[model samples]
Target: MEENFKMVAKTLFGFEEILAKELLQLGAQKIEKGVRSVSFYGDKGFMYKANLGLRTAIKILKPIHAFSVHNENDLYNAIYKMPWENYLSPKGTLAIDATVHSPLFKHSLFIAQKTKDAIVDKFRNTTGQRPNVDLKFPDIKINIHIDRHQCTVSLDASGESLHKRGYKTATNIAPINEVLAAGMILLSGWDGQCDFMDPMCGSGTILIEAAMIACNIPPNLMRKEFAFERWQDWDVDLFEKIEASLLNKTRDFHYKITGYDKAPSAIAKARENIKYARLEDFVHVQHEDFFKTRKGGHQKLHMVFNPPYGERLNIDMQDFYKNIGDTLKQNYPGTDAWFITSNLDALKHVGLRPSRKIQLYNAKLEARLVKYVMYEGSKKQKYMK
Candidate 1:
């Protein structure tokens, strides 16, 4: 039987709870949430499953060692004492990614370089051979994190960011991150209950993520590679078994997932991405200005999107935001609209009081995910300030 080991899944800010819940559902034990990260105990196969199944996780890391380091020499000596031979050969390629939050260490790159030097020097002294660095494709990807006087070293189980879901072949200007898109849909609490729409869908990221969530599909199933696949103990059969298990758990989605864009080029790119993800059967995309269209059918609709935040697209911010509110108030009823924007000033022009406003971040910009509920009937709706 395989032994259980502790692993941590890092995510964006404000997604730790959702990521922890995802780990819990995946049968992980000892689940605990930290700032922007979740730690759990699982075996090798469970590691594969977590990497494949988690939607909001940025990367899953297996902690090998932790120590108190007061200076660079302590950090180097601690790293040199590790059994790197168990994970990679002296001839294999390697990569180091470091993050520092301590006043003692200001440059993460220098820390990474010091780590690389320590590992290579140890190997060369012992075996007269050293591993080379390959940032893009490495046999072993190492993560170094220093917080105050404590340092933790881990092996990155997911090579690239999990956000690279391998579905988007093309992108429009300022496309939303896949991890962010999935997190947004989950935050909206859309469980494929009714129709879903991304009225300003760009490259169809939100729509693809929504379909996957609604159908219980694993997000990383289509990813090109994971860092674990190159490890010394890589298990193809175990990975396939985990994949099959996840596939077996997938439930069919009954509601339609739709996307719209004013640009024909965006529509084309969205269709291409949706087709790539093999979600065309469940999703539909069209080129239509959302302001000029009205909601169809009587069933309740759930909408989530990342509309223009006035930074990339050249548009009048005040008028554009007003039109969004006007369209929802006049054309759409029985609908719940949710969107994220960095422009808090423009958000005021929406004119409807947000029942829920959650603070989040879009890369570096502070953003808000606001929700506005449009009533079902012709009864007078309270448009709060």
Candidate 2:
């Protein structure tokens, strides 16, 4: 039997608690949350499941070694002394990524270089040959992290991040990141219960993400490969078993998921992306301005989207946002609308006060993921008040 091991799932800021909840729901054990990451214990099969099933995770890392470090030299010496033979051969290619949170080690790029040098130099000194570094298609990807003089090394189990879900072939001028899209959907508390929507759907990312969430589908089933597949201990049978088990857990979604984009190009791109995700039947895309339209029926609705932040797309920022508020208040009654935007200035224009606002990051820009509740009628308006 394969032994249980500790693994870390890296995520974006403000998603640690949600990611930890996801890990626990996925049957992970001894889960611990950290800044932009969550650590837990599970077997190799569990690792495969976490990689395949997690929605908010950016990457899953399996820590192979850890030690205390005083400086760069100590970091290099420790990496050099490890038995690298079991993980990668001298003939294989590798890539190193480093993150620094230590006073001693300030530069991440420098740490990556030192760690890579330690491994290759150790091999070259003994065998007159060294493994090559291939950033694009490396056989092994190593991650180095220094936290206040404590250094930890791990194998990057997720290749190219899980957000590259292999579905988006087209993008708009400012499309949201896939992981962020999934995270928003997960945070919205939607469970395929009723119909879903993204009124200003730019590329249909939220719609596709919603469909997958509804079906309990594995987010990375379409990914080309995981980094662990290149590891020496890559167990094909166990991986297949894990894949099959996750596939079996897929559920049927009875509700509809839909998207609307005002721009023709965005609608075309959304259609293309929905097709690529193989969710065309489960998701519908239409070209319609959100403010001009109202809810199709009196049914309850769930929405998640990223509207223009006025960063690159030059629409009337305040007016556009005000229209969003008006549309929801007038047209989209009995709906829970959620959108993430970096436009703090524009959010002020959205007349109605947000019911809930959560701080998050959309890349380097600090942003807010907010929710609003639109009532059904004047009778309900009193209740909302």
Candidate 3:
């Protein structure tokens, strides 16, 4: 039997709790949460399961070594002493990604270079040959983290970010990150119980993620690759078993999941993405300006999307936000409307107050994931002050 080891699942801001919950539900042991990360114990097959199943995780890392370092030499010496041959061949290609939160190491790039140098130098000294650096597609990807002089070197189990689920061949002007899209739906507390909609679905990322969530589908079932596939001990049979196990757990979703966009181009892109995901049966995309549309049914509706944050696409910030509020209040009754935007000023113009506002970051921009509940009956929209 394979022995269990510790692994860390990295996620975006405000998603640690949900990621932790996901790990727990997936049968992870001794789960611990960190800022934008969750650490837990699982065996090799479980690691395969995590990379395949975790929706919010950007990357899954297996920490191989941890030490205290104060200077560059210390970092190099630490990495050189490790048995890199166990994970990669001397002729294999390698890539290093580093994150520094310590005052001692000011440059993350330099650290990455130094780590890469140490590994290749070690290979050259021992085997008379060294691995080449291939940043794009490497046989091994390493992660270096320094926090308050404590350095940890980890093997990245997921090569590219898990967000590249291989289903999005097309995108609109401003497509939301797949990880963030999945996190938003999970945080909204929608579990396939009600109808789902993304009113301003740009390329239908939110809609696809929401539909996957509602159907209890593994987020990365359609992913092209995981870093572990190139490892020295890559177990094809074990990975297949894990994939089969996750697929068996998928549940059927009965409610409708839909998206609307004003632009015909966006509608076309959304349709393409939905089709790529093989979710055409469960999701529908339409060309309609959200501000001009009304709720179709009396069923409880769950809405989540990322509207224009006035960053890339050119749109009237204040007026667009006001229209969002007016449409929800006047038309979308019995609905829980949630949207994320970096435009703090524009949120005020929405007119309707948000019942919940959670702080998060959309890349470098500070953003808010706000929620507004519209009443079903005679009760007017309660604008929380």
Candidate 4:
């Protein structure tokens, strides 16, 4: 039996609680929440499960060593003393990613370079050969973090961001991150109970994530690889068992999941991506302007989307947002409309007050996930007072 070890799942801002909840539901022990991160204790099999199942996590890191450092030499010496040979071979390739939150260490790039140097030098001095650095494809990906004077070294268990999901082959002008899309859907409290829609579905990310959530599907089942596949103790049979276990948990979804886009190109991309995900039976994409459309059925509906924030496009921010509000208020009733945008000024133009506003980050831009509830009754009494 494999003993449990601590692992950290790194997530975006405003998603720590959800990630922690996900870990807890996945049977992680000693769960702890941090800023944009959640830590927990899980065995090797569980680690494989996390990388394969966690939707909100950008990466999963397993901390291997920790020490305090005041200077560069201390950092180098501390990292050089580790048993790198056990984790990588002399001919293997390596990559280092660093994050610094300490006054002692300033540049993350320099920190990454220094850490890589220490490992390479250690191997060269001991075995007369060293691993080569391969940023694109590496056998071992290391993570270095500096908080104040404490340095913790970790192994990257997820090679690429879990958002890749191995399903999206096409995207529109501004496609939302898959992790952010899933996080927003999870936060909205929609659990396949009602009909789901993404009116401004750029590439259909929200729709796909909603279907996956609705079916209780593991998000990373289509992913090509994880970093642990290259680890020294990589267990193929164990990983297969974990994957099979997750697949068995997927339940059938009965509600409709649909997407709409004003552009035909966006619709094509969304359909392509949706077909690639093998969710064609559960999701439908149409090329139609949202402003001209009305709710089709009287059943309770849930809408989550990433509308343009007037960032890269040249659309009128005020009128665009006003139309969003007008369409929802007049056309769609009995719907919980939720959307994310970084344009604070434009959000005010929506006219309808948001029932809930959550501070989040869309890439580097500060954003808000706002919800507007449109009731089923008369238009005058639709909005919450």
Candidate 5:
């Protein structure tokens, strides 16, 4: 029988609950949600399944050791004491990523360097050879997380952050992050039952993510590689079996998923990315400015988008936000419009009150996911909800 180990699935902020629910659905036990992460228990095969199946997760980490530390030398000594040979060979490659929120150690990079030094020193002292560092493509990726004085060292089982679903080959000036896009669509509770749209779509990220969710597709099926592919006990046959099982679970999709971008260049890039995801058939991208277009049909439209947030603060974001509200109220009735933006100062200009507002983060900037409900008529532009 395979052994069950603890694994942590990391995700973006505001996705912890959805990720926890996803873990529960994947047969993971002892599911626990944390801020921007979810912890669960699973075996090697379960780890493979989690990496292959979970759409909302950024990476799955398997913790190997935990200890108290207040100094750099303590961190290095603890790392050196671990059985590094059990995971990788002297000829193989390794990568270390450190995240620290400790008053004792303020620099994350310094901690990563110390951890790497410890691992290399252990190998050199024991076998006179050390594994090389390969940042882009490493055989094993290690995660060093320090919260206060306690540190947890774990093996990163999902490489490339899982957001690189190997689908996007092209992008525009403001293409949304895949993981964030997926989480937002899921949070909006849109399945394949109704029509969907990304009115101001920059590069069709929301559209592509919606199609995958609607079809019950494995988000990482198009991905080229995962960290487990380089593990010592990597079983290709087991992986294939897992992949086939996930493929078998994909259900049929029966809704129209569409996207529109004002710029012709953005439309072209969205088309290219959709093609790369092999979902061109399920999604349609067109060059159309959201403000100029009206609702195509009476069908309830599920809309999700990330409009331009003036990072330079040059444009009058207040006016752009007001336009967004005006366009939805006047043109897109009988629809639910949801979008994320970091421009809080401009939110007040939207005029229409949001029925639901959730706090989120876009990189370093604090953001909000706001929803406005449009009725079936133009005269009553105010949100019904």
Candidate 6:
């Protein structure tokens, strides 16, 4: 029988609860939610499943050591004592990623460098051969996290952030992160019971994520590789079994998933990405201005999108947001409109009071995920005026 061990799944700022719920649904035990991470207990197979199946997680880490360190020397000595040969070979490659919140360590890079020195020095002193650093692709990736006076060293289980879902071969100027898109869709409570649309589907990330959620498809199934694949204890047979198990659980989606973009280039890129995800059968993309379009059918529609926030684009954001409200009220009744934007000023011009507002962040920009419920029939008329 496999033994259960502790693992942490790191996520964006506002996704801790959503990620905890996802972990519970995935059969994790002793689940505890932190600020931007969740800790749980699971075996090796469960770890593989978490990396492959978790939609809201950005990366998973397996902690190997923890200690108190107030200075660089203490940090170096603590790391040097670890048995590195168990995880990496003397001739292999390695990479170190560090995050520090201590007054002692102001620079994360220096801490990473100090960690690398300790590991390499230990190898060189023992076998006269040390591992080389490979930032892009490494055999063993180490993570150092220092909070105040305590430090924890972990092995990164997912490489290159799980947001690199291997589906988006093309992107627009400001493409939404895949994990954020999935988290938004899940937070909006869209269970795929109705039609889904991304009115301003820049690169079709929301649409692709929605389709994956609707069908119960694992988001990382198409990913090229995970850091665990390079570990010494990697079990190809066990990984294959986990993959087959996840694939077998994918259910059929019944409703339609659609996308729209004003730019022809965006439409083309979205189409390319959707095809690459093999979600063309469930998603449709078109080159149409969302403000000039209307709801196609009477089915209860669920909308989620990442609209431009005037950061890079030179346009009148106030007028653009007004148009969004006008189109939703006049054309798209019986819909639940939800979107994320960092432009709080432009959000007021939407001209509709949101039923729910959740604070979030978009790449360091303070943002909000607002939901405006447009009721059907006469109730919709009240909000229209």
**Against the true structure, whose lDDT is highest?**
6
RMSD, every candidate, angstroms: 2.1, 1.5, 2.2, 1.7, 2.2, 1.9
- Measured against the true structure, the TM-scores of the candidates, in listed sequence, are 0.98, 0.97, 0.97, 0.97, 0.95, 0.98
List, residue by residue over 1-385, the lDDT tens digit for candidate 1: 9999999999988898889989999999999999999999999999999999999999999999999999999999999999999998999999999999999999999999999999999999999999999999999999999999999999999999999999999999989999999998899999898999999998999999999999999999999999999999999999999999999999988888989999999999999999999999999999999999999988999999999988888899999999999999998898999999999999999988899998888988999999998987654543431
Supply candidate 3's per-residue lDDT for 111.
96
What lDDT tens digits, residue by residue, belong to model 6 across residues 1-385?
9999999999999999999999999999999999999999999999999999999999999999999998999999999999999999999999999999999989999999999999999999999999999998899899999999999999999988999999998999979999999999999999989999999998899999999999999999999899999999999999999999989999988999999999999999999999999999999999999988999777899999988999859999999999999999999988999999999999999999999999989999999999998887877486787
Clashing residue pairs in candidate 3 are none
Identify the runs in model 6 with alpha carbons over 4 angstroms from their true place: 380-385
Q: Which residue pairs show collisions in model 1?
A: none
What ranking emerges by lDDT with the best candidate at the front?
6, 4, 1, 3, 2, 5
lDDT of 3 by residue, 1-385 (tens): 9999999999999999999999999999999999999999999999999998999999999999999998999999999999898999989999999999998988999999999999989999999999999998999999999998899999999999998988998998768999999999999999999899999898999999998898889999998789999998899999999999999999989899989988999999999999999999999998998988999878899999899877877889999999999999999989999999999999999999799999988988999999999987645334441
The alpha-carbon root-mean-square deviation between model 3 and the true structure, to one decimal in Å, is 2.2
Give lDDT for model 3. 0.93
Q: lDDT for each of the candidates?
A: 0.94, 0.91, 0.93, 0.94, 0.89, 0.95
- Identify the superior model by TM-score, candidate 3 or candidate 6: 6
**For every model in order, what is the number of clashing pairs?**
0, 0, 0, 0, 1, 0
Instruction: Please write out the lDDT profile of model 5 over residues 1-385, one tens digit for every residue.
Output: 8899999999999999999998998899999999999999999989999998888899999999999997998999999999999999988899999999999998898998999999999999999999999999999999999999899999999988888888887887756788999999989888778999998777778888899888888888888888989999898888899889988988787778888988898898889888888887789988888879899878899999998889733677988999999999888888999999998878899999899999988877889999998988653454553
